[model samples]
Target: MPSAQSAARPAARSAAGVLGLAALTLLATAPRASAAEGWSLAPAGDGRPSFYAEGAPGTVLQDTVSVTNSGSHPVTVRLTGTGTGTGTGTGVPVTFAEPTVRVPARTRADVPFTMTVPAGAAPGDRSGTLLAKDADGRTATARIRLHVGGPALSALTVEHVAVHGDRITYDLVNRGTTVLVPKLAVRARGLFGRVLLDRAARTLPVRLAPGTRTGLSEPWPGRPALDAVDIRLTATAADGAHDTAGTEARFVPWGAVAGTAGALTAGAAVTVVRLRRRRAGRPAEPPPTDTYTDRDRDTDRDTDVELTGAVR
Candidate 1:
């Protein structure tokens, strides 16, 4: 039999142990919840996932980004803009009003920013990111897409065309305000108007931005061994962009030609030597002699005397 006071002591100890276990569990879960509900960054207004802007070149576009601190502690973060996609330069020209912001617990900070379209920016879409980083090196990002407005012009040119052995090389230039994926066609004609090569137009594995140039080559595996060829390259892109360039190449068998030339030179030398020898070996001609001997003189005199008597 136990005393009531002792029984009450054991019950009180059990109750206190249960209470302590409950307290420990609560302490462990509280920190996890706080860490899980950490900070975030997003576009300022509405529920849009990213920021978007559109304007003409040499114009300034404005937008806002938000830094939120959902935990019980204050958060200080730094904001920056990183450029992506095909744009004028490496980074988007993002200028922030407050580059650094301090958000109170359960509060949000709105930061205003301006992105300037380059004066010579081509008409196309550019993208970037709005980034926020804290002292703990934790980072958050929000995307921004920008479109520049202008007349869409498509122009291209092929240049520096040349043939090297079994390959034809050329450069493609984008001269317009838009991006271009070019298609190439190759044609070659021999000296006698025969088509040596005719390759249909096919898509090239490159993208040409405005005012960009890229060098490319085409392979001609079974090229003519000896022929004078004219090679023409035509490049085309969307929106009526087109250009053509050409070059001439002559392939000669120099070794065979040299051998034939040497043989001909040797034959000419032999012929000249033979003619000289024939002339050198010929006998000399006899000296001229007067046939007017004493007999001849008497006959001429008698003829003259007869002629004179007849005349008389």
Candidate 2:
């Protein structure tokens, strides 16, 4: 039989082991117990994001925010904001009414945030914060800076399809972003509005001066004959590039007449010259004036009469 002292010692060691394990389990599940206990909101370095435009009451603008856990634990983030670059992007009762997102540890999550400015929201620079909260109710913040410009650029009008013979013309104005590098696929329509030209260029380098605009006038074949035409511009920029603004213009087919007329006259002149040269190449006719005509005529007649009689 074991002594009581030895028995007590074994039991004590077992109890100690169990208690130690229980403590470890508690530590593992407890919400971050320290000041450094929460997950951080890491941006994939999309330079400070913002959307600013002058909007009327009840304007809805949408934007996307990409987040990274960048920590050892999972993270949950909330979104709230108005569309324009300014004003209480976040509503007054301001809370991102979205279910919290669980960004996996060391992974990424692309969260979409929407902002609706109140009908009477004043214009200017309005700002807010996107809160990234952890399970522990701890948070990291990303500042949301927005601007309310004079107005949201709604429609674009690109006009003046000056046809220099077969070349098309363009004048791309970003009415919004500073400079937009766009892709150009020109579709030309006729009087019946049928597509006469449909072609795609991988990329057209567009550089527009801030607040001003850029213009291009290059002609392409298969342009439909219409009083005016519609040009659709699709532009894209990188992360650091400016906004994506699709624009169009109503242009007049004004100068195409001049080009067509000039082409015809030039063609006609070439034909006239060719005909004159052909006539000049034929054999020349001798002078019709009678140098020996009368005398030769009479002599030839008498000789013919005499020769006839001799033969008979």
Candidate 3:
């Protein structure tokens, strides 16, 4: 029989083992913490994911960004604003009140900023980013969307129309404050007013931003070999944007012209050689002669007889 003291000892050891296993199971089931949960950046107030501003050109807009530090130590960060997208001409002009901020542990720092719409900025939507970086090379960013307000104008122009070897080239210019995906129509006529090329209007594989110019070409693999052509290009876009431009081109078959010129040159040389030969084979001419009639001979004899009688 075991003693009571030894039995109590074994029972206590078993309870201890069970408790240790339960503690390990609880730890394993708990959610793990993220490494980057130390600091964060976001828009100030209202739980908005990004900042938005709408204004006319030359208008100044204001907003705020928050930098929060949840770590035990203080965090020092630098803030910057960077613009993106084709609508933003140069960039989003972001000016921060405090470019550098130091936030104590478990505190948030709110920084104010102003974004100015460029004086001559076109009416469109632009995007940018607000960035916060710490000394450890850790970075956080918040997005910014800006819309420039102005009267929408839809205008475009077709310019510098020309014909290359087997293609027609031209430039499309956007003259309005809106984007354009222009459609092009090509027409070409020959010297005798004969339609050489007639293509219907179709969408082009290009997107033209405001105040931009793009050079493009159309293929003409079956163009005429010899003809004078008048090429016209018309570009049209939505909202009443339209323009047309024309140019003239002449195509000459130099091979055929050279062959004809060579034949003419050979004929001229043959004629020159024949004339020289004829002059060389011809005989020289003699001097001119005179003749008297019988009446003249009788008159001369009578004159001689009269002279002899006078002398006797």
Candidate 4:
């Protein structure tokens, strides 16, 4: 006859398959000491169903997992780890001292394992599953969460800013390790330094996760139709992270401006020419004529007569 542990493993494996990809919390079976069924698995703690550990990057954390055989037979099982979801990405590496172990009926086996955080791991939380599979394809699982320790940073940036129609679009990026709820402020100036828009910062509806980039937009219902404009945006987070960006736009009535300038130049030229012509048309004043006295003419005639007689 099969041992109690051997008979229980197959039934457990079949149950795990039917559960499908259930969440981590649902995967925890009964505690090692309180197994009501053929076999069970859990964290080494007396009351805890899952495992939680914290360490810095490049550090190795040690923990224990327990497999309890409640049935009347012995069971052999294999151990491994599986990523829960794409947490802080690729998941922290999990390794076991003994990959296979045998648990006697009504006995529990405690296995030691190491979770090594990668040297390049970002400061965040990651999750995985500690799985125990028996020879008969039955399985039991425990959830494990590892938190990489570091300073929480709130760096953020606004990028790819542009104006399309009456809307202003941009990309929000979280450059630091912490989650952020950002607030935005907008200001715009028109030709001659007129303040066209000045809106104070307001909380955004969405949250930004670390190392994530999301596109967002602001409305411009009062956009200028005939002036050059400068638009600026400022973003701020609760943790004092802030950034600013700007763009320029121009709206012009080309036809009207060209026509008006041409008309004014033509009128000024005509006025100048008319004024020059009037100055040229005026005649010069005649020189004052000296009254030649009768006496003077007689004297000149007598002198001329005397000169003529001498020559003869």
The whole-model lDDT of each prediction reads 0.75, 0.46, 0.76, 0.75
Ranking by TM-score: 3, 1, 4, 2
Give the per-residue lDDT digits (tens) of candidate 4, residues 1-312. 333333243343344346431212222443332233488887654457687777788876766677878888888889899865344445658898788889888787767677887786667888778888888888888777777778878899999888898999999998987778999999999988899999999999978877889999999988977988999999999789999998999977779899998887787677667755765896875554687678877996997677545433
Best candidate according to lDDT:
3
Model 1 global lDDT (CA atoms, 0 to 1): 0.75
TM-scores, in order shown?
Answer: 0.72, 0.30, 0.77, 0.59
Please write out the lDDT profile of model 3 over residues 1-312, one tens digit for every residue.
Answer: 221111232343355355431110112222221123598887665566677677789877766677778888888888898756655244578888789888888777767677888898998878778888889888888777777878889999999888888888899999998889999999999988999999999999998888899999999998988999998988999999999999999999999999999997787677667766776897864433355667877986997677545433
Candidate 4 whole-model C-alpha lDDT, 0 to 1:
0.75
Per candidate, the number of residue pairs that clash is: 0, 24, 0, 6
Give the worst 10-residue stretch by lDDT in candidate 2: 21-30
What is the per-residue lDDT of model 2 for residues 1-312, given as tens digits with 9 covering 90 to 100?
Answer: 211111232343355355431110111221221112434442222333332223344655444344555667665655433222323233321333243666666666554344555664433446555556555666555544434344433222344445565676655554442233555555555445656566664566554332445677556665444545544443344323323222233444569878888887776676656656765896886665757688877996997577545433
Off by over 4 Å in 2: 1-38, 42-45, 49-54, 77-97, 149-312
Task: Let me know the TM-score candidate 3 reaches against the reference structure.
Answer: 0.77
Residue 285 in model 1: shift from native, Å? 11
Q: In candidate 1, how many Å is residue 67 off? A: 0.9
Q: Which stretches of candidate 1 lie over 4 Å from their true place?
A: 1-37, 86-91, 264-312
Model 4 quality (TM-score): 0.59
**Once model 4 is optimally superposed onto the true structure by TM-score, how far is the C-alpha of residue 8 displaced, in angstroms?**
22
